[model samples]
Target: MARVYSIVSGKGGTGKTSSAINLAAALNSLGEDVIVVDANISTPNVGIHLGAPIVPVTLNHVLTNRAEVTEAIYKHESGLKILPSSLSTQDLGRIKHENLVQVVKQLKRLSKYIILDSAAGLGKETEASILASDEVIIVTQPEMPAVTDALKAVKLCEQLGKPVKGFILTRHRWKKSEMQVENILDMLEIPAVGLIPEDKNMQKALMLKSPIVNSYPKSKASKAYFETARRLLGIKEEKGFFERIFGS
Candidate 1:
């Protein structure tokens, strides 16, 4: 069955877009057809993240009926498909948030998985994406402000009648200064997709305009994202440390 997942965050800088990109890339590497949509129509970043900050046709065009969804779809070198939004401020005023549902319907016919990188906040754009998705994935960091915002997001999902697949705790470093993992899990009271460890290679991948899954496939963040995808698909995990760490 095909599934659409909206990677949402209550606040910005929670690594929401990064989680969406890496998870989609990981799912693609595992032989699934995945399309990542930059649902942050106001301040989109998927294009910027992947180095093509500008494109001929974008999600903005699709929303405005200027272009079909298929026309706006761009192929990444990693074989993952990306549907990015316009960077132009002119396009923002023209976008109709409700049209996303229909656009997503069109995408469902083309791919097994659709990952919507939602706007980093509780905005109408994020709500539209969440409403159009089959499941919602909350992204947050190991901090009170982020977690509190994530709780609000969880409640929002509950109110909006969206099923939260789980939460992704990103940039986690097991330190005395950071919130303990146990406390976070207890506070959120939701299933955990996985924890992404802090990895310096993430910055390198950003510099290379590529996802860590492709740029540093062996890195901790990449591996964690892969594991997270496996969990999403209900794939039984390999128990061996060597296999989990270095499997083909």
Candidate 2:
């Protein structure tokens, strides 16, 4: 059975969607079959991030009994399959959040990893995604407000009995103003799985409508994402000799 990880955040602009896309890409690069689903039905962006802003079928169709989950699956040039939600506003009301668990169950048979890019904040859609996931990875910024909100998300996951796969910190600048890794982990009561640094190349990758890992593998962000993927798969990452000599 595939492991379903719902990439969630307590608030928007925390790079939850970006983390989901890049992590899926990184896993695929490691020879794993991965499918990313846009479970954020109301404000979906997985399709947009993958360069397929529109598709004939989507999660919305699957939930409403209009289409099979397989029909919404689209393969990106990078080899990662995505089940994106419809971009039309009209489809929002038609989605039955209760069907999400069944949809996820169907997807588990298709890939090694099923990444659900859940909506930010505590809402009906987010709740549905959380309940369906086998585990969750909370994405947050290295700041107070974001971390606070992430704590709320962590508590909710606890209440639902979902295993939190730990926190993935994004847009990290490594500046003094940002929250320290140790403190963030302690406060959230979750271990640090990955720390993605702020890289200018991310903007270029976004403009080109491709994952940073695929577009700029040499960039810091891509390297961090790859490391994150390795950690998730229980693969040990070896540091370069130069880094070992200079201290990472």
Candidate 3:
């Protein structure tokens, strides 16, 4: 069965896109067929992150009746297939809300996991995307505004009948401990999947158009992503305490 997840943030620059791309790669590395659907049609970055060429066909093509969903999908060498959005400014606000749900239903049969990279802010498309997802991964930074927006998103997801699977904190400096994270979770009432500290290699990896998991597997950010994937899959037999500490 295909599990559909929506990765969203209350605000932009919360590393939501980065989280989606890296998590998708980690899941694929673990032998799961993953398709990352870049629903952030207005500002799609998955293609740029994965180093895939911007093509003529994309999610906009499918929604606009210019191409089939299958025809818009590009298979990356990293073993992750992507259904990217068009770069045309003309299609920025042209997405049909009804068609969004239809498109997701069509994609469910195509992969073991469908990770939707939603645009920041609560809009028609964002709401519909979350509503269609079975679970949500709310990404936040260790700041007040991001935390506020994340809380609103969590509430909205609950109202839409979508269970928030967990939260993921990114761009953290580790200056604060898990207590700060726990407080935010207490407000949103959701457990965290993991934390990804900010790293310079992330930008370098982005420039290279490859995920850290594949480009620099031993990096702290890469190891964090691996642990997040393991938790998401509920893999038993946890890693050694010292191994986890040393890796972090």
Per-residue error for 107 in candidate 3, Å, reads 1.4
Backbone N/Cα/C clashes per model: 0, 0, 0
What do the candidate models score in CA lDDT, each in turn? 0.91, 0.90, 0.83
RMSD of each: 3.3, 2.8, 3.1
Candidate 3 lDDT tens digits, 1-248:
88999998878889888999889999999999899988888778788888874887999888888888999898888888899887777976667855877888888988888999988897776787797688999999888888889989998887888899888889777675433665776776787786888889999999889988888888888888888888788774356632353332
Summing lDDT over every window of 10 consecutive residues in candidate 1, give the lowest-scoring window. 239-248
lDDT of 3 at 12: 84
lDDT of 1 by residue, 8-61 (tens): 989899998899999999999999999999999999999988887999999999
Candidate 2 lDDT tens digits, 128-184:
999999999999999899999999999999999999998899998979988977788
True lDDT of residue 97, candidate 1: 99
TM-score of 1: 0.95
Say which prediction, candidate 2 or candidate 3, comes out ahead on TM-score: 2
Candidate 2 structure, TM-score to reference: 0.95
How well does candidate 1 score on lDDT at residue 20? Answer: 92
Alpha carbon deviation, residue 159, candidate 1 (Å):
0.7
TM-score of each prediction? 0.95, 0.95, 0.92
